[model samples]
Target: PFRFSALTRSCVVIPCTFQYEEDIPLTRGIWSKKTGGIVFHNGQSNVIDHFKGRTKILGDLNEGNCSLEIDDIKPFDNGPFCFHAEKGHDKYRFNNSCVFIVMKSPEKPVMTPVPAEVDAGSTITVSCSVAHTCPSHPPVFSWSVPDLSSEISHTLTSPGIWETKSTITFMVAAGDGVRSLTCTAIFWRDKQQAGTVKLNVK
Candidate 1:
């Protein structure tokens, strides 16, 4: 059982893995909720209204990945959802494979390890990223560096994991020696978190 928490009005990706006894080709993927009620299938029909067009299998079915994505999270969308698959002539429903979705609160972003030494007059770029569910309102990154230029980007780094990163490249100065480099993640609804690391200029 796996779970993901998405922010309201955001999106959540629920990763799922499946197995079979035979080597037949996987032909279809299905998602059901609350006692076998199909919430998602190919096309629009047979899917519940609330989930129509908003839910789909993000993973490749042929690869035995039935991961699901639900966009624009609503309060009623909280679910302990399940996945099913059709492999050639054999069919199976993974009633035991359930993934839950929870609404999340903002958390601090983390930066990759930076080198301990930076040379004066040399340009360096530092990247910071955070996992978030909401792509529409991704967390924004801010730097404590004065008058520095930075680049911000978003990417789905893994199943159920979306990342927003901020990168800054700056010419190091002797005055920057032994200074703190801080990165902050500003999330939806005024939620914020930050992390800092020491930067040593040689």
Candidate 2:
């Protein structure tokens, strides 16, 4: 069983793989809900309307990859899903191989810089963090400063929740007084929120 978390109105990828006798040729792949509703199929005619243009197969069938991607995810999309495949003249369905999707709303990020003030020619570190409920789908952090060196880490804040932090270090110059550092957090479904901190360089 695979568990995944995503933000509503975002996208999610379900990882899948299959193996069979070397002589068997893989024909097609399918992704469906627990109720047997087709989310995606190699043939267009069989796919459900709600998932027609929103779903895609991310892997090559011939190589035994059956991964699926769901776009514009909705709250109702939360649930268990399964994969099916066709190999030569035989069809295979692994009921036990399933994924459970959990969706949540996104939150704004928090930014912190130690000392808040720094001396010219001094080095400083700024940290940006955010809390998210899905460790399986942790939020991604990025800095607005171009070519900036940054490090990222995550901690389990609680059951099923995680806190991710991104720290960036830079040297301050006398002329670079009153500068602002921006941090952007990207969550599932591509939803993004950002935070900024102002620095006073003496």
Candidate 3:
């Protein structure tokens, strides 16, 4: 069955199937995310990494259902996710694949920063946000600061799926010039982390 959703930060179910003629006790299915010419491993062994805490498995493994539950969705996550499932048999094996299209809300995302450019010794504020996903729940912002080598601050407003923002403060100096600063906001609904921007300090 085909599914669609107006909500940007939401998980959509895609029904899939895999069958084998032999009596196989265990059938395995694989889920992979393709982004920027990189294939992110979604599921393997028992659980997924980074995605383990966020992703939910809706399909029945024994029944040969390979449907996936994508969480913390984002616009960047929109792509042709290839789902493959295989059933091993005595002589031959069976496999299947499918694609899903995740739609985003018109609201999209708008990032706001306290200062576009910061000085050597000061605090910097960067807000990662989305216009709207639903009325009851608002978007959250989460900041990602790799250069500072410090922890990030995340603010949540509603359902874990809505949005998250990260904020950080840094005291810059000549030594920090080689380092890079970045802020990332991940919509919990689809596990979509947006493109990172370089922090500018004066």
Best by lDDT: 1
What C-alpha lDDT, on a 0 to 100 scale, does residue 153 get in candidate 1? 88
| Model 1 regions lying over 4 Å from their true place | 21-24, 87-90, 111-127, 134-159, 171-202
Query: Candidate 3 lDDT, tens digit per residue, 91-200?
Result: 22234353545476444445554455566666555555553333233334444443353333334343223343444445565433433444444443434445355555
Cα lDDT, all candidates: 0.77, 0.76, 0.47
lDDT of 1 by residue, 1-202 (tens): 5767777666676878776656666778888885657777885798988888888787777676777778767876777787878756666877457777878766678887778888777777888998887665688777887536788888998667788988888777666559788888887555688999988887
Model 3's TM-score against the true structure: 0.38
Off by over 4 Å in 3: 1-6, 34-52, 86-96, 106-202
Looking at candidate 3, what is the lDDT of residue 127?
50
Q: Each model's TM-score, in the order given?
A: 0.66, 0.66, 0.38
Q: What is the lDDT of residue 3 in candidate 2?
A: 82
Model 2, position 125: C-alpha lDDT score: 74
User: CA shift at 38, candidate 2, in angstroms?
Assistant: 0.9
- Please name the candidate that would achieve the greatest TM-score relative to the true structure: 2
